[model samples]
Target chain A: MNLPAGETRELLAAEYVLGTLPPTARRRVERWILLHPELAESVRRWEHDFARLAALATPEPPPARCRRRLENFLKNERPRRRLTLIAASFWRYAAPLAVAASLFLVVVLVERVRTVERPPAGIAVLVGRHGHARWVLTMGHDRMHVVVVGRIALPPHKSYELWFEPRAGAPMIPVGLLPNRGLMTARLPAAVYVRLAHAHLLAVSLEPAGGSPTGRPTGPVLATATPQAV
Target chain B: MASPPEPALPSPPPEGRSEDPLAAAFLACRRQDPRGLEKLYELLAPQLFGFLRRMLPRKDLAEEALQDTFVNIWRRIEGYDGARGEIRTWIFAIAHHRAVDILRRERRLVPTPDTDLESLLATAPPETAHEPLAQLEETRLRDCLGRLSQDQRRVLFLAYYHDRTQEEIARRLGSPLGTVKSWMRRGLLGLRRCLETP
Candidate 1:
């Protein structure tokens, strides 16, 4: 389990490259490679050996959306300390204004709901990588209601951050960090709501407990969903 | 073990070359040149996409894995050491890992087909008319791969291309678990020897 020796190590390296190793054994070998330089060399050799076979596959051009997405990701990945500082200032002034705006919107939304019986404007069921529905978001006129339908175990120090990805080439806007469980309402600002109206997809990524230190996502994106009219 | 009869494969085209540009791009990416990253994508995305397409069941899923692979490569590029292996191998490792993750996730949702092994093994490799490799490398690899026993070839193909676990392969092929493991080990060993010779 620690460090495989001799022929065993070579076989393990090959199996690892071959994708036949079980998850546990695969993790063990990966860790072993980091600790022992010789094992790493062995794995590299095996990787090169099989790489030739990879060429046998017919090349496929990825979808146009893929290039756009990668470009956007790379753009967001740039260092923007200045932008983060501006965001901090903007949030400071906007927080109280946002609270007052939400209270007024809630009253108006409540009145409208009583006057007319209508379904949610949009609904998105965000499924995790495992295909389990994890979060359900219902878009109202001025607010978005999110419900955690399934439990996503997270490190105590980590949290799930949500973003609204507009259909246009706009950068992903930070929505908010999802609570560990249960329903949480986010009062969407007019700018965000306007963008959300045109947005087709919502993305959720895992970030630090407080949320992304960077203005943009700094961790693995867990799921994405396109909201449907309901 | 006696080698299998070699198939008559056409000489590969001369267009595709080595990984030197990719390696240089990696170096530039390390220095935070965004253009270098874009160049790397242009050079490698097709090859990675091809591998992912065969590995995953759906094209959309393959695309998602491809995106994730590049994102991960960008994030982890700082840790890349050229001395360990070619950037090509490292990139493929990341992509293959991503495809396997998707497969595992999908497997959890639905049971794997028990007869997929037979069907996949029976199917021929897709024709390379549209996408040919370098002539010498292609000829050498095809000849060497053809030399492997049918069982060895099948096992290696399923393992490398489809990301099938030995246990799953055993169930799919209707063979004993131990036999499947032996086939995988022997297949890889045979391939290593065959490729090493000449």
Candidate 2:
């Protein structure tokens, strides 16, 4: 589609800078700005002009807790940076190991194809402390199908719960409770679906018979799995 | 590694109040100084939080946006080129973009029935009176905004302050989407012409 001409183009840029363009249009303009210097210049000009409008709003200081939150974030950031570097190094050394593991997982998945209903958008294999796969999670269109693959033993009145971490260092959201045997399906909420779109990790925590009473996990984490899109 | 020692925390000045402190804090942030990040947050948080509170629907969302804005500023400080524009503008742009992202993700970009456009226009006069050029720019903006028809001004205000999309603005005003788009375009064009005039 042709870019809006002359005055329309400038106004579109103004809307983009003002943050009113719909997602798709905003994304299209973002790509357009990269290819068109004039569009990019207009965006920059509008950014400068609209920056003053921010002053038109009353200046209310953020709550005091916000400072404490920032302090905690900064404190965690340094260690996370180091962890990222270590992760990079680990990926370099463990590349072949990960490839082998992926091939093994594929073979297992192929063998279990008769049990799975449809093609999965993503999958994760949660393992126990002994390095054995305890459960397999397959993400479908609007549900997560989980299958217990290994023998699990739990104390009385205890169950395992699933949690999804959309991004590293972000809080984990409780997905659902894990079944000790047989298949279980957990429906996904729109918010959860949005979060799962960018999720990288899944974990299992031992909880009460029903699930975590609190919205958050209240038990010791038992296992973690790296979620991968198929 | 040990974190850098933090300097004393001074109360943040009002919006458009002090440039030197913000610039200094920005420079410190560029150097990877924690103190600078602290100072920058102190300096920018008040105005940014207020701006975000108006842009987002909920107080918690505004607070999260404010926090994310600082995180982005800290992470991307190395990429910031001073030649392009003032750091304050750049910071506001970051916060605004973050707010939009949240609005889109949460699907909160709906028509807000109770947005008081008149009060929005009446309150929050720029605190830049001490700085003649900034005050002049603010005055020119207010003047140019005043020149537009109420429809045009309302469209701009809803989009800018309330994060309303054109469709939402149309719904809010009981007008056609095409009409809302024209109002936005004409209003922006009129403001540009007026502000650009010497």
Work out how many backbone clashes candidate 1 has. 0
CAPRI-style docking class of model 1 based on DockQ: incorrect
TM-score of chain B of 1: 0.75
**Cα lDDT, all candidates:** 0.67, 0.72
For model 1, how does the per-residue alpha-carbon lDDT over B53-84 read when each residue is reduced to its tens digit?
87787888889999998887776665554555
Q: Which ten residues in a row have the lowest lDDT in candidate 2 chain A?
A: A189-198
Task: State the displacement of the C-alpha of residue A65, model 2, in Å, after optimal TM-score superposition.
Answer: 1.5
lDDT of 2 by residue, A86-174 (tens): 66755554444544555565566656556545566666777555555677776655666666764578889998988876544434666
Give me the candidate number with maximum lDDT.
Answer: 2
TM-scores of all predicted structures:
0.54, 0.59
Regions of candidate 2 where Cα sits further than 4 Å from its true position: A1-5, A19-28, A79-86, A90-230, B1-19, B105-114, B128-135
Q: Which stretch of 10 consecutive residues in model 1 chain A shows the poorest summed lDDT?
A: A111-120
For model 2, name the residue pairs that clash. Answer: none
Residue B4 miss distance in model 2 (angstroms): 40
